[model samples]
Target chain A: MVGSDVFRAKFFSLYLPLTLYLVFLLFPFYWMLIVSFKPTNDLFDMKFSPFWIQQFTLENYLYLFQNTDFITWLKNTLIVSIVSTILSLVCSIFIGYALARLRFPGSNFLGLGIFLAYLVPPTLLFLPLAQVISELGLNNTYWALILTYPTQLIPFASWLLMGYFRTIPKEIEESAMADGCSRIQILFRMVLPLSVPGLLSAGIFCFTLCWNEFLYALIFMSSGSMKTIPVGTVSDLIKADTLFWGALMASAVLGSFPIAFIYSFFVKHYVSGLTAGAVKG
Target chain B: MAANARLKSFSMRDFFDRERNLGIMLFMAYPFFLGIWLSLTDSMIGRAGQFIGLRNFVDLLTDTIFHQTAKNTFIYALVTVPFKAMLGLGLALILNRHMRFSSPVRAAVMMPWIVPTALSSLGWFMIFDPVFSPISWLFRNMGLISKNINFLGDPILAISSVCWANIWRGVPFFGITILAGLQSVPQELHEAAAIDGASVWHRFRHVTIPSIKGVVLIASLLSIIWTFADFQLIYILTKGGPANETHIFGTYTYQIGLQATEIGMGAAISLYMFPILAVFAILLLIYLRKEQ
Candidate 1:
C-alpha cells in the first residue's frame, strides 16, 4: 500500500508536469521532422493523418539540394559567421584585458559605455548603415555583414570576457611582471591560456548569433547568391503564389542542424557563460 | 629623443584604447550619429535630400498606421514579458529538482532557444496553417469546433499567434538564467525554512523569491528591451499582414525605409525604439553597480 501510494505521488508531482512541458516544447520540431519527409500528396491531403507518416520519402531533401541555391547560402553563412566571430574574439580579448586589469583613466566609464553600446538595437541602425555600406561600395557584398556585425559582437564579447578576467587572481599577473614579463607576453602566455573556457563559450555564442542574424543579412545582401541561410531560406523558398512546405521545412531542419549539434556539446559552458555575464553584473 | 621616450612609455595603453575606440567609432558611434542625421533629412535610396528637422516625426504623428504600430509594439512587450517571467520561473523550479534524466530534459527545454528564430518560426507558421493544420485536425477530431480555424487570417488572432511564438522562444532563456541563479541560492536556506514548519508556498515566497531577485530583475529588463525591439517572429510569421495589423516598430521601419524607400521616415520610426531602451539600460546599469 505504501509503495503504491509513493508511486502515484511521484507520477502526479514530477512525471506528469514534465511530460506536458516536453510535449509542448518538442512537438513543433517533431511536426517539422514529419512534414519534411512526407510526400506532396500526403502533405496536402486532408484524409491522411498528420501525426503518423503513411510513407517516407527523401524527395524534399533532394529538391533542396538540387533545385535551389542552398549550397551557396550554406557556404556564405559559414564564412560570415566564422570570420566575424574570430574578428570579434580577437578584439574583445585585448579590450577586455585593458578594462579588467590595467589601471587606466576613464576605464570604468569606458566599460559602461561598451555595455550601453550593446543596447543599441540593430533595427535603429540598419537604415543609416544601408547608406554607409553603399557609399563604401560594400553594398550587395559579403563585406557589408562582415564589417557591420562587429558593432554588436564586440560589445557583447568584451563585456563577457571582462567578467571572466576579473575572476582570475591578480597575483599571477603581478608575479609575471616581477619576472620581467611584458604586459603583452603575460596576456598571451598566462591569461589567454587560463581563460580558454571563456573564449570557447564567447566564440560559440558569437558564431551562433551571426548564423541567426536576419535583418542585416536581409538588407545588406540582396543578391540570391550572396544571401545567408536565414535570408535565403525565408526569401527564396516561399514564393508568392505557391508554397513549398516540404522543401521549406527540410531547409529549416538542415539550417538549424549545425547550431543544434554544437549547442548539445557545450551547453554547460554556455550556461556558465550566460550566468557569469548576467549575474556578474 | 625625449618625446620618443615618452611615446614609448604611453604606447601600450594608448594603443589598446585607441584600437578598441576606433572600432567602436567606425561601427557603433558613426552609424548612430548618422542615423540621427538621416532622420532629420528627406533622404531616399540613391538620392540625398535637403535637411528637414523633425518633419518626419511630425508626419508620423499624424499617420494612423504609425499609431497602430506604436500600440502593437507596446502590446507585444506588455503581454510577452510577464508571461515569460512566470513560465521561466516555474520551469527553473521544476528543473531544479533531483529528477531522472535531468540533463536530457534540460536540453529538450532549450531546443526552441537553440534553433534560429527565423527557422523555428517557420515551424510555427506551418502549425498555424489555415488548412491541413495538425492543430485544426486535432481540434475537429476532438469535436471542439465544427470548422477549420484560420490562425493567421483574423487580425487579432494573427497578433496573438505572433505573441505566442515570442513567448515560446523567450521562456527558455529566462529559465536557464534563473536556474543558474537558483543553484547559487544555498540549499540550507530552503531546508531551514522547511524545518521551521513553513508551508511550501511560504518557503518559496520568503526564501526563494528574495534570493533570486537581482537575477530576475536583470533578466526581465534585458528581455523587455529585446522584446520591445523584436523583429524576426513578426516578420517571418505575419509580415505585418492581414491588413497590416500585426506591424511593430521593426517591421514597420523595414517596410517604410526599405520597401517604400522613405529612408528619412524609416530612420525616424526606428529612433522611437531608442528612448525606451535607454531608460531600461539606465536601470540595469544602476542595478549592476549596486550589486557590485
Candidate 2:
C-alpha cells in the first residue's frame, strides 16, 4: 500500500508540471477560439467569465469571407505552397538519390553544401534575392515567390531526402541495376516507393513553410491579389481602425486549419522526420 | 569491334558525368555566385552604378544602426535560446512518462507551433492592447494593479513582449524535439537507478543528460538560428517600434531594404548574418558526424 502510494505521488509530481506547461502553451489558442465565437462587445468587456458566451455568433466568420479578400489570399497561398512543394520534392529526389547512391568526384561536397545552404537563414538571403527577383522582372507576381521559395526549400528537402535515401538498403537498387534497369528506372520504381513517408513529411513541411512564410510575400508581392495569407492578414489588420478581434481570430483559425489537419493526419511521420534531422544533427 | 564499342561507352559515360556536373553548377550558380557578386558591387539601386569595392562593408562597420541592430539580435538570441531550452527540457522530463491522456496533451501543447506566427502575433497584440487586454482586466479585478498595463508600450517591456511571443512559438519545438529524445532513452536506466537508491536528480543528470546531449545541442542551435532570423513575430506585433528598441537584424534588414529601399546597405547588413550562422552550422555538422 505504501509503495503504491509512493508511485502515485511520483507520477503526479511528474505529471503536474507537464500539464501546467501545456496549459500555458495552449491557453492563447483556446482564448483565440473563445474570442472568435464571442460577440464583439463581449470580447472587449473586462469580464472574467470563462465559458459564458453572452451571444454566440458566426458573424465574424461571415465577415471574414464576404467582407474581405481572405479567400483570394487563401487561393494564392495554396498555389504557391503546393507548387513549391511539388517542385522541391522532384528536385530533392533526384539530387538525394544521386548523392546517396552514386559515387562522384564532388558528390560529398555537394551533399555538405546543400546542408549548409539549408542553414543559411532566409532573413540574410532575402535582401540579395530581392535584387535578383527584381532583375528577373518577376516582382509583384506570384511567380516571384514560387521561384524564390524553392531556393530555401530545395536545400532542406535535399538534405532530408539524402538522409532518408541512405537508410534504404543499397542491395535493392544494386539488384535493379544488375537486371539492366537504368538508374532513373531504379529511382522511380524502387527507391521512391520506399521513401514515400519521408517524401510526405518533406512535402508537408514545405507546404506549411510556404503557407506560413511572411517576409517574401510582404516584399516580393505587393498587390492585393498576389498577397499570401500571412501578409494579407497583417495588411488587413493595419487597415482597420479598431481591432477586428472576432474577424481576425476567425481568419486565423481558418487559415491554420489545413496545416493543422495535415499535422494531425501525419502526426507520427512528422515527429519522426523532425527528430531524424534534429536528434541526428 | 568490341574494343571500339567499349571505348565509345567509356566516352559516353564521361560526357554524361560532365553534363551532370554542369547541371549542378547551373543549379547553384544563382544563389551561391549571384549573392556574392551583388554584395561586392554598389549597383543595388539602379543598373548604371559602378562597382565600388568594399565601400558597403566599410560603411556597415561605422553605421550606428547596424551596431544597434546587431546588439538587439545577440541579446534576443542570448536571452531566448537558454530560456526556451530549459523550459522545453523541463516539460519533456515531466511529460515523458506513461500517463493518461498524454497523447492528447502532447497534441494540445503542439498547437501553438502549428498556428501561423502572424496570426498568433495578431492575437497576442489584441491581448496586449491597453483597451482590450484581458490580462490587465484580470490584474485590475484582483487588485494587483490599479491601471491597465501597456505591455508593448514601454521599451524594455516591448522587447520582453516580443520575446514572450517568440518563446510561446518556440517552446513547442524544444518540447517536441526533447520528447523524441526522451523516448529514445531506455527505460531500464531509470529502473536500475531507482533500484540502486539513486535520486531522480542523479538519474536525470547521469543518464538523461548524456543520452540526449546531441539532441539538446542540435535543437538549441536550430532555435538560435530561427530566433536570430525571426521577423514575422516582431514585425507584426511591434513593427520595431517604441524607439526601435526591438529591431533585430531580420526586421532591420527588411526595414532598410524593402521599406526604405536602401538596397546596398540592406544587403550589407543582411550578409553580416552569414558568419554567425556558419559557425552554428559547422558545430551542427560536427555533432551530426559524431552521432553517425
Superposed model 2: Cα runs more than 4 Å off: A1-11, A47-52, B1-50, B191-197
**What lDDT does the true structure give each of the candidates?**
0.87, 0.78
lDDT tens per residue, model 2, A1-281:
99999878975787667667867887777767778888898865656463357788999899888988999999999999999889888877877767666666666787787777677777877776777778789988878988878778888887778778888887676666656776667778888899888898888888988988888888888887788888887888466577788888888778877877778777778777776543552
For each candidate in turn, the TM-score is: 0.96, 0.91
Per residue, candidate 2 scores C-alpha lDDT tens digits across B1-292 of 4433332243323223557535544544555455566666765466534577778878888987778778888878868888888888887777686778766667677777877888778778877787777788778888999988988899888888888878888888897898899888899988998999999789989989998887888888888887888888889878887777788889988887667776666676777887888887888888788878
- i-RMSD values for every candidate model: 4.3, 5.0
| Chain A superposition TM-score, candidate 2 | 0.93
Task: After the best TM-score superposition of candidate 1, give how far the Cα of residue B38 lies from its true spot, in angstroms.
Answer: 1.2
Report the C-alpha displacement of residue A182, candidate 1, in angstroms: 2.0
Q: Is the docking of candidate 1 incorrect, acceptable, medium or high quality?
A: medium
Candidate 1: tens digits of C-alpha lDDT, residues B1-292? 4433332353455348666576675678788899899999999987897899999999999999999899999889877888998888988888888898787788779989888899999999999989767999989988899998899889998989998888888888888989998998998998998898999999888989998888888888888888888888899989988888999999999999999999988999999888988998899889988877
